[model samples]
Target: MRNFWGLMRAYWFSSSWKEAWTLTVVIALLTALSSKAGVWFAEASGELINSIAFFHDAANTTPLTSLLENAAFLVGLVVIKDAGITGSRTYISATLHRRWRAWLDNRFNEALLDANHSHFHAQHGAGTPAPDNIDQRVQESIKDMTGGAIGLAMGVMAVATSLYFVGQKLISSSTEVAGLEFLGSYGSAVLAFVAVAVYVPLNTWIAVKLGGMLEQLSIRMQRAEGSYRGELTTLLRRSFHVAASRGEDVQKAMHERLYVDIDQTWGRHNIVSASYASFERVYNFVGARIVAYGPGLIPFVHNRIDLKGYITGAELVNALISQCSWFIHVMPAIATLRANSKRVIEVAVAIENVQKPDEFYRRTGRSEFRRTSQNPVFGLTIQNLELAHEGHDTTPFLAIDQLRFRRGEWIFLRGESGCGKTSLLKAINGLWPYGRGTIVLPEGVKSFYAAQDVRLPQVSLKEQVCLPDAPKDHSDARVAAALHKAGLGEFIEHLGDVTRQGKGWDQQLSGGQKQKLVVARILLQQPGLLFLDEASAALDPEGKIAFHQAIKDNCPNATVVSIMHEATPPRSASGTEFYDSVVTIADGTVIKKPLQPPLPAEITEILNRPAMRQPTRSPAMEEGWRRIARLRLKQK
Candidate 1:
């Protein structure tokens, strides 16, 4: 309940709430006026009938024409009132619902971005769980709840007011002298009381239970979609051969889960809907009986003022009609209110967790030791760095003991497949959890981190290169130049006109093309430090050579520390190579010896050189021979 109030307060704080509330009040007024108008017409018609009956009993008098004239005016007024009410309610409800949905969307987006970065990654990391489907929940479920809350509140208030009016009118008339008034309303008070008591409790219980079901079904639906989408994404990333070997089984299981969930959800929805309908019918029936018996309790049989003088038949008929309409249409509205309340609570709790202040800033040593400083010589320095998983008190996962990457020097992190190479890249980029360390970065130097699987947005090939915020202006000529440097010149030309012809950058490009596009983005940004995680893996050897040359030509002073799996190394310029230092790790430990650098020419030229073509044994076959030589030397 408290959570529901907080979620609602989000709307109260927004600029739209003032207008929404004004519209709500207007609609409520319209409903009240329209309802009263309906009763007014019925009352006038009944009085006309009584006046005619009185004249017939007198046997020598003409009918009272005023009652008949009043009936015509009342009917016309009701028609006008009803039309206005319908228009006002429809417009107000729609305006408020859309406005509420928009506000909720903005809030959800804020929460998603401000959430703990490490926690987001850990829960949604590679092959662990899919993040795409949570987006559906954020976009759809939250939107429904926010919009429904407004509609539900308005509906409950309207119905409650109607019931209150009926109770007041009936009780007043029921207190009259004995006879028809006493007999008719004697049982009505007790029946109406029992109906209200029984119906409200049942409605509340069923609404709460159904709300719980919807919550579970919402989560299950997201999971099923995530599983299917994740499998498809995996297959698209890996080669056909590699994907077929392992991914087929995972996809099949995910498909099965999706079907099972759909089946269960359908059954649950049917049961809840049927239960709601049954109770609604009973509630409406009781309301009809109360309204019909109401007039009998008005003492229509007074001696001087006969039955027609005390109460008119039209009031009874009109009350029954109005009460029935209100009772029948209002149950779903109540149930929706209950459901939205629960949803609001869930969102409130999530927001609270995301907003909690960090404890890292409170520690004493943290302030002095972990402050970011400028280093003139080395591009970056990590002092006594210790890393740990977010939201856990477990032991440190990895530690980097006082490492430095000198300016204008390249370093490589080579290791087995799953040895935290990517995690290290993330930490260096300040995208991970806080650790006990001091990181010194070069003054006024910018850095960019490019991941292995580059995110290809839905736009055409050109806009994807710019990203997040659109560039001031997009030039086809500049785009072509970047593409040419990255060995994608032919592909870009084939795409035609390139501006109007393509969607943006993402929709029209393949994986290799997108990788080229990312490199184009890097060139455009031109940060001082380029952190590449297999950024060049998609290109062929010649393409890789072209890309590296282009990087050197475009961003000459920039330092590149990349994760590479190639046997050959990059070349040098003016007798000094670009990669001055190599940091290679095998089985979690650094290899001390320096590797034989690439020959001072293109890798293709180096491989084709006559000296390189000299007969060489396969390294795997020579391992036994090398072991024997080592043993012989040891003996000496």
Candidate 2:
């Protein structure tokens, strides 16, 4: 129940709760009105049958005018119920469902990007044993749960109203039944109600017992579909690698395997559902009709009840039986709702786990990390630092007793491929919290961390270059200036986007140009501290050198840390624009080797550059602008 409320209380108690409740109340009123209309329509139609029988028996006594009135009344009721009340109820219910889904989606999206990077951890086995397959839970399961709950509410309302109508019929037919005269007074209504009550319970019991494992089966089916969907997305995301490596056969085999699992789960769920569904449409459909109408016909056949009484009794009884059979009709839907509800609750639990602070950073955890600030002279300070991966525990991967960099120094982390250079850098950046350490960053400054892969989100080129900084914050001139500084003058037109016509971003830029794009991002955002984990490893040596020079020119004051898993850190012949130090890690030991003579001229020269550097309008940049102008004119 707590788990159930975890998924419920969030929305029911949220800011939109009032509006949700308002729509719900409107829907409920319309539903009651609609159900009442059904009862009236039944009553109206039954009386017409009575009127027709009267005319047949005594043509003189029954008026043709009265018969026409009854027919007109039925037509008016159908119009009121079908066209007005039912239509309003549908629109209101759909509105409520849409609002509920939107609220839940926002909640999940926020949890997926929690403060501690637990979203990243959740991808691995940090909080849950398997990947949550959260996209399926959010997209498919949410829809089923809300839609099913509303459907169940409608069924319940129908049943409740029908029982009331049935009670009125029973009261009218209180006298002794023809064949059950021994039972005396109240035999007709009392006995029929008793028989129906007993039969419906028995039917419901059979359905529940047969569908016991359906919740688990539904969960399995959901997970199976999620797996297949995740695998399909993975195949698309890595299609470039697959095509390059010619791994189509391998990808095909994996997809087929996932599809096979889906088929196996689907077969199991269907087999159970088939037996379950048969209760409603096949068994109850025929049985309920017989039970309601068959016995009522007996009295008419015996001439104990007139045709008028028989028709009215049959109408009420049929309505009652159909309402009672709702349980049998809804057994399959109930299982699906429960399954979807359970899956949603599990996701709620996972999000709860993710929203908590990292286990290492919790106040009650085993380790403690103290962070302070250092001066430009002191650079970055670290002491008693140890780095390790989250799931791997033992001795730390790398240990640092003391390390410091001057304010404007460039450094490289050099070590073997599997060593902890990248891990150590991440710890300093706060994206990694699996280590125990004290990292004194430069006082009051924003820091940046670039991942190993180039991040080109499917957005405008300006947005890509101004990433980590909104395009709204910088004007077009400033953005173009940043691009010019990074040597991407031709890419200026793609500032809004180049992904139109027959060009894709992957097609528009080469491998080296993509690295330059990251450099452009660095120039634009201009963080006081920068950590690069193979951010430029894809570039050639000359390109790498140029990337360094661009940063030195644009962000000379920033503290730079780059990972170099290759051999020794390269130093230029001038020694003015290269790594100031190299931190090497091996065998869980730390070594900082200061590279070359102390540098001052390069720093002075960079400091002397213009306060607002202007981008020289090269011919490529001018032509790019001209092209954009022509496109805008055409748009006008």
Candidate 3:
């Protein structure tokens, strides 16, 4: 219940509260008006039937003009009531749905995309597995929540209106019966209340149990479906390796497990659905009959009315049944609303939990960055940092007592796989918070990180290079020159074409080409601090040298910290001797050493046999080299 109210307050008390409340009130008014129209129409129907009966019984005295007028009025009332319901339902529902969806999407994005919040999600697990299908949660869950809320609200209003108007009528028309003076006029309302009092407790118990079961089943089924889809997508991504290794049998077994999971979950859901449906049918049948028969039974038992009055009593019974039927209709809607509300609140709680750590930091007045002094010579300073994975109390992954990199120092970080090279980098960037650390970085320093796998947006090539900002921020000439230096000059012609619509960079470019594009991004942005984690591992040896040389030439003053599998010592006379330090991490410790210049023999061999040392280059590559030379000369 607490969680449910929290979810409600999240939206109802959001920034759009005024608009949301206005729409809600308008919808309620429309619902009330429609309910009143329904009651008026029912009364008109009863009066029309009674008048017809009167005219038939006394043909000489009855007026035909009065019958025609009643008929016309009934037809007009039906049309107007239906039109109001349709218009109000359509407009109010659409507006409220749009508003709720927009607000939820914004809040979820703000939470999930925060730097600390993102790290938390990446490190820790939500109590129940976090929702894998965020798009579905944002789109489908919000749709269900908003639509079900409106439906439940309108249903409650219908019941309230029916009871108020119908109960008043029943109580107003009174009569004495059999000298006991029993309250005959209030019989229907009293019977309806008694029936509800008897039925609601049992029905509510069953509905609550079944609704909880169904909600759990639904969550499991959705998770299974998402897993199956993810498996298929992974298969497509690794099709080549799977086919090469003849992994068809293994993949088939994995797919079968996913299918079995979905099947069992759905089977359980169907059982609960069947049980609830049967119970609903029985409850409605028994409750409606009890309310319908109560009005006629009273007068018949007491002998209070003649044959004509008994027939009139039957008409009144039918009228009461017609008005009170909303009780029966709203039962299933309440159950559905409960289940959907649970699903929505589960997602909301997950997002809130992930963001709590960041909230704590903000409340304690702790900023993400810790700066020692203004404009420090060192771009990064790490002191007594110990890093570990979340939920683990074992030895730390990488521990550094003291480390600092001055501005314009080109440093190569090398470590074996799973030796905490990448983890250390993440800790330095304030992305890993599972351990004790104080990292003091220069304030207002611009930084860029390129991971092993580059993820470009589905936008034009020009825009992708200038990502997280507009392409117009950089001059066309500078963008083209950077591309040329990064060996992507050939793609300059197709820069305007969107990298989507089946023409994504992953499909259109080779692995080496993609890495070059990442390099192009670095060259274009020219941040003061750059961290490259296996950024050039996909390229050939010559290509790697060329990109490193380009980075050195273009951004000489930037601090470069690169993580690689093996350290590549620079040649002596190639102007690639800028690397100042080499840091190697192993056994949860770091060792830093100054870079040594290449041996005299290595420089002499490279100069004597250039063709034997260097890989063959295509015309585009030659043009790229020439462009790099021109850029270097212009820089000088």
Which candidate should be chosen as best, given TM-score against the real structure? Answer: 2
For candidate 1, write residues 134-199 as lDDT tens digits.
454556656676666665666555555555555555454442344325445443444434445555
User: lDDT per residue, candidate 2, 1-636, as tens digits?
Assistant: 127656655676788889878887787778777766766776787778877767656554656877888889989999999889988888888888788888877777787766666566555445247346778887788888878777777678778766776667556675566769987766667656866777778887888876566767877888888888888877766778999999999999988998898898888888887777775566665554666666567666777777666666666666677777786677777778888888777766655555544552342232345678866566888889877655444466778898887778888888788788777876786655566789898887778887667646677888878887788988898889888877899878767874856666655676678778888888888888888888778877777777888888889888898885567565554655477887878898988878755435544443335741337767776556545545554576
| TM-score against native, each model | 0.74, 0.84, 0.82
Identify the candidate with maximal lDDT: 2
Clash counts per candidate, in order, are 9, 0, 0
Q: Candidate 2's C-alpha lDDT?
A: 0.73
Query: Which runs in model 2 stand beyond 4 Å of their true positions?
Result: 51-55, 60-72, 164-187, 210-212, 294-305, 360-377, 389-393, 502-510, 570-575, 597-636
Instruction: Rank all candidate structures by their lDDT, best first, as comma-separated numbers.
Output: 2, 3, 1
Q: Which ranges of candidate 1 are over 4 A from the true structure?
A: 15-17, 38-78, 114-132, 160-253, 290-348, 355-371, 375-377, 388-397, 473-481, 489-507, 567-578, 587-636
| Stronger candidate by TM-score (2 vs 3) | 2
Give model 1's TM-score versus the native structure: 0.74
> Candidate 2's error at 95, in angstroms?
0.5
The 10 consecutive residues of candidate 3 with the worst lDDT sum are 362-371
